[model samples]
Target chain A: MQNDTPELPIFPLILSHAMRPLPLWPLSAGLSRLAGHILHRHPGINNRIDYYQDHVFLLDITDLPLFLTLEPRKARLRAFRRSAVVPGHDAGISGPLAAFLAMLHGQEDGDTLFFSGALAIDGDTAAVLALRNALDDAELDLAAELAELLPPIAGLLRAGLPGMQHLTGLCLQRGSAASERAW
Target chain B: MELVCPAGTPAALRAAVDAGAHSVYCGFADATNARNFPGLNFSRAELEAAIDHAHARGAKVLVAINTFPTAGEEAIWHAALADAARLGADAIILADPGLLAHAAERHPGLRLHLSVQAAAANPDAINLYARHFGIRRVVLPRVLSVEEIAAINREIDIETEVFVFGGLCVMAEGRCALSSYATGQSPNMNGVCSPPDHVAYTSEGDDTVARLGGFAIHRTPRGAPAPYPTLCKGCFVSGERQGHVFEDAVSLDASRLIPALARAGVSALKIEGRQRSRAYVAQIVSAFRAVTDALAAGREPPALALARLAEGQAATTGAYAKRWR
Candidate 1:
């Protein structure tokens, strides 16, 4: 059976590689702001991950030359170059950006991604599980969340999301009927 | 035969129903059921909607209040029973004897099924529940062989439901306390086994080590697929032996034995994965539905390649054939 699952687009990889020469400080600051915004919007996410408040989570986007460290206690999300000697973290989840997005959009199962070797978890499995569970409950939409944060781009983002989703075969929204049918 | 499916959320319930499930089982988002995990299960309102959706599709909804209640928290279980009956659940699956008694006495009109958590393996135990609590069905533990199941069915009067696919419990259901020994939470009491709060995976050299409550369960080579750190399916050093001393990291796949199970007088085939995603529920339920339909039509059951959905991409018949023994 020809696997109909869409392959990760090269556009993101190209963009990620282009950003490799950029400074990490601005990205870290932006991510921190976004994290704060998400927390403010979804207070339940904070409460869900409260058990891992003392722990640090590393989100490794394998396709991108970037690594993100999330500190729930501090409400901080810092970014680092993939090659950087990042400080120790309690747990780490590494996967392609699409896998992460698919999970966040409720398109794919977290355990399925892990089982299929599309994602890998190390360090603290419990902490990773807590984060995953929290996110699952949150039902995040990166595009919508970003649009809400930056209203000027809201219309463009909302209009472009479907096109991007179709091109990438990524479910960018929660309860996507197309993704459900594709399954 | 009935096709019983698991639904952790309202979406999963709908998916199971749309995929041709004869019945779907779910639990409230609490410790009242064995699959009490974070971000899983339905709220009361969700359960109500789910029941309506399933019923609208000519399917039944079985609510699972299968966990054993705490010493002083009997009221919670009782409330769950009352609420399930009020929500018009086709049946309430129960594991505790006291709770079963309460349901039988208080909700006389409601149908009751013995949870696999009750570990009612023998005819006497099953018949005792049927005779005492008026349970119409019993979800048998995954520890019995097909021959043993047939023998038990010949002696027992109530309908029998057996797990057809998904995660396998190495220990007898309702009795395993390895999770409690490691994490202080058990499926029987807390409705979770190898509770996620205590499970961790860390990289050691070129290998990934999965642990439950700091107890090393399995270590796999880096980049290789690793199973969940379920205590029973763990690797341990027992004396000089250094391997999975208890059971391998494999999920149960009894699809091949549907005919035998039917011939053995099984009433229903249950799929074990409320914690799984709706996509998984739909795929699995549809596959089993096809198999059951084939059996009913007197056609050969189609070869189903479901290993991709199985744990660690491996499947076993478990104790169904007594081959492991």
Candidate 2:
């Protein structure tokens, strides 16, 4: 089988990274500030990606001009135009997603692309698919840029929790398993 | 006051019908049905026989074509609706808007019961279904409490059905993909979730771990009785927390809440397992039958009797309590 080994899913990878209660994972508000910083440093890669953990990001164009956030909570990248910052865990994001957004920020028009099948979208499929056609035109390899930009956050998390990269390191070591009643 | 129950096979159908179910619901053996599990549902011949058996016993039969129709390929679903209408079934449970439109136009008199998949929680959504497709009753999503159901009943003209037993999905019906994310198959698309075919129970040393799509959900001692790894009930590590983050190994049994549900204006009560054996079906249906009958006669209700059936799995009133919100 040519595509035999399913590419290690980036959706779960980023989610596992963001699963921390630490103040490092950038939320929506923090993402806006990060976006502003990127716009200043790498003006070429601004507002061309939308991030979601629902199923997958339905990027209609490889290079779009908006970053939509759909995980942990429902928020969008363009939301920063008004408030620019939000309270709570809005700013904390895993290093992987931050790297991906930075890649999409510098895309050109008419770039249609599809992510791997079933990207862990926790929301409605049709609603997200309906919004798929609205994508900005740009060209940047999200998967590649993520690797380059993730080193700092990775070091920080690894330092806080020793040997945190492997599967065994992510063991549920504390807290109520999950408030079963909260379901 | 009819009690519609799920039957995954002819034997279960007979069990439900024999157990004094006012009505029973099942599906054709294909993707057209929601409980499209392996070794479940009925063939065309089996469906006819099931309907014949139910009708002879004075119990009704409903055929469910509840999963959403795939884009650009709705012919399969449309034909299922037609075949169901032709088979003289009591009613057809439908969810997709396009499919409902198709059925309403083609089989105009074919009765339509809104599947819980429609998620018509609010009056506006319910009214939309009623006005456009003339939907008669809606199997309300498990997300609502009894008080909310009464409030909804007050505002809508349609009858309502509430789940009283079996598997529980924590998310709003039809608005989730946790299973499909881990395993490629999904309830809304392929009609199965965390599909049993993809599940593997492996012995890793002294521990037994339940794996769905190769991800570990829970690991217990090898001697422990491990449950199937359903996504909602699966254990996950989030920050420092681990355990059943979404739910536990419990199935829902709101048998205790039937009276409250009755008072809340629910016209019918539904049991969720279409995949159980004949004897299990008989026991549960019989118990609930007596409960509803007593409630109808204005007599004091009997104490609950399905504790052994609930087994080690805990039972909850589920979203009937708003703590889930």
TM-score of the first chain in candidate 1 relative to the native first chain: 0.86
- DockQ for candidate 1, please give it: 0.31
- In candidate 1, stretches whose alpha carbon ends up further than 4 angstroms from where it belongs are A1-13, A21-56, A69-78, A83-91, A137-183, B238-240
CAPRI-style docking class of model 1 based on DockQ: acceptable
Worst 10 residues of 2 chain B by lDDT: B305-314
TM-score of each: 0.86, 0.62
Tell me the whole-model lDDT of each prediction, alpha carbons only.
Answer: 0.82, 0.61
| DockQ of all predictions against the true structure, Cα-based | 0.31, 0.01
| Model 2 spans > 4 angstroms off | A1-183
> What's model 1's overall lDDT?
0.82
For residues B1-325, could you state the per-residue lDDT of candidate 2 as single tens digits?
6788878767567768877899999998677887775445677877888888889889999999999887877888988898888888889999999999998898999889999988789888998999999899999988889999999999999999999887777786755677777877766755546564566555578865667777888776643434435777777898999878887766678887888998899999998777554445666788889988999899877867553344223567888975752
Per-residue lDDT over A3-73 for candidate 1, one digit per residue giving the tens place of the 0 to 100 score: 12324443365667797997889888888888888878876576657668778898987888878899976
* Docking verdict class for candidate 2: incorrect
| Backbone clashes in model 1, listed as residue pairs | A125-B200, A125-B201
